[model samples]
Target: MREVVRAASLLIVLCSAFISSALAAGRILPHAPQIAFVSAFNNSANLYLLDIRHGALRPLTQLPSLQRGPVWSNDGLRLVYESNAGNNNINLFMIDVRGGPSAERQLTYFSFDEVEALFMPNRGQTPEGFVFTTVRGPNGDIFMLDVPPVGENNRPEL
Candidate 1:
């Protein structure tokens, strides 16, 4: 009887520890909306949030667009993707990685817009910001923009 009681106590203690740890993490995740995108239907991509607690899925983008590649910001607060939404060419857009519609902010708009900014981890962020390549006449040019602090949006400081 004593051995059985000890086993039961150990089980209860372990279970309690797990429950508390889970609850603490749950409370902290909502602040970011936690999201991931997947192919929901034919030729379309949709984002879903893992409830983490219930394992429930939530929809993000609904309209059909050639969505592929998910890139996260250094801070993990933003996601950049390529999609066919208004422009005929591939464009770069940023979104809140957490959840919701997370409207994309277009990074470039051109007749043959190509997102030249995303270079993955290898493309080191310079003292300014991201180094970019833009077409000029028949040749392509390389440029750099210093990363600015929040609330300082203006034409690239060049």
Candidate 2:
């Protein structure tokens, strides 16, 4: 009975922490009324969209990897986030919110972790893409990746 009680207590504490963190990390889209967030309610952390007015919840990602730092594009048509999908190192990925899971595209392929991604505003003399930090050494390096144009074959340029 004591062991059961301890386990339940620990679960409650963990669940509370998770909920708090998720709520704190929620980001509202710039051009839309929906908010993007990460949640582990389905056992694995994945991106989700919450309709602010209607209170509708939609899961954006269903992969068995941890997704974090969801940032909306300038136009709010897409989202960029970090995910540890293929390996232990986290990489940046972009997905069209309306395109569903199939629209997800891996942005960085480095062995080190890339995180804290955000889309750059389209302005004079500024390229269109997102900026992210790469954890390579003692200090994290910031990089700006240009958005690749989709080729005629319907694939992103490498």
Candidate 3:
């Protein structure tokens, strides 16, 4: 009986800790603006955000390079995507969802192309980072990038 009681108490404590942590993470916006999905027309593609609630559309990226595969950050405040950058080399870049002077920044500058990037979903697993496929000739491998924390004005430690 004592063993069972102790087990039950431990379970209750663990469950409560999980619940509180989740609550502390705060709530995701019910209708945050969605990702920019470029549409193909006349062989042209550009980033655009669509607000389904109000049937509104806004252009987010206007660059000559081909942009594709946009993934939102865990906080939903930023977006990371791939751009060819007219150098025949695809690289990763980020943009703030909200318009501002510090809206855009190039995240990766590499001769080898990186694509299909995805932000780590679990905050605990990757405090600030993402993973993607790096293409190098006939060989390809998965790589992880640890992003710098916001508002720190410091470079990523590679």
Best by TM-score: 2
lDDT of each: 0.48, 0.74, 0.66
What would the per-residue lDDT of candidate 3 be over residues 82-115, giving only the tens digit for each residue? 8887688988888887878878777877888899
Q: What is the lDDT, from 0 to 100, of the residue 157 in candidate 2?
A: 28
Clashes in predicted model 3: 0
- TM agreement with the true structure for every prediction: 0.49, 0.76, 0.70
For model 2, what is the alpha-carbon lDDT of residue 107?
76
lDDT tens readout by residue for model 2, 30-99: 5566778888765678888876545567888889888989988877878889999999999888888887
Tell me the number of clashing residue pairs for each predicted model. 6, 0, 0
Better of 1 and 2 by TM-score: 2
Over 1-158, each residue of candidate 1 has an lDDT whose tens digit, in order, gives 67445544543553475453221111113244343444435545554444333345555456576554454555655555555677566655556655444254555455554444543342554433444565555777665544344344344332
Off by over 4 Å in 3: 1-35, 41-43, 124-127, 151-158
Where is model 2 more than 4 Å wrong at Cα? 1-24, 100-102, 124-127, 151-158
Q: How well does candidate 2 score on lDDT at residue 12?
A: 54
lDDT of 1: 0.48
- Model 3 compared with the native: what TM-score? 0.70
Worst 10 residues of 1 by lDDT: 21-30
Worst 10 residues of 3 by lDDT: 21-30
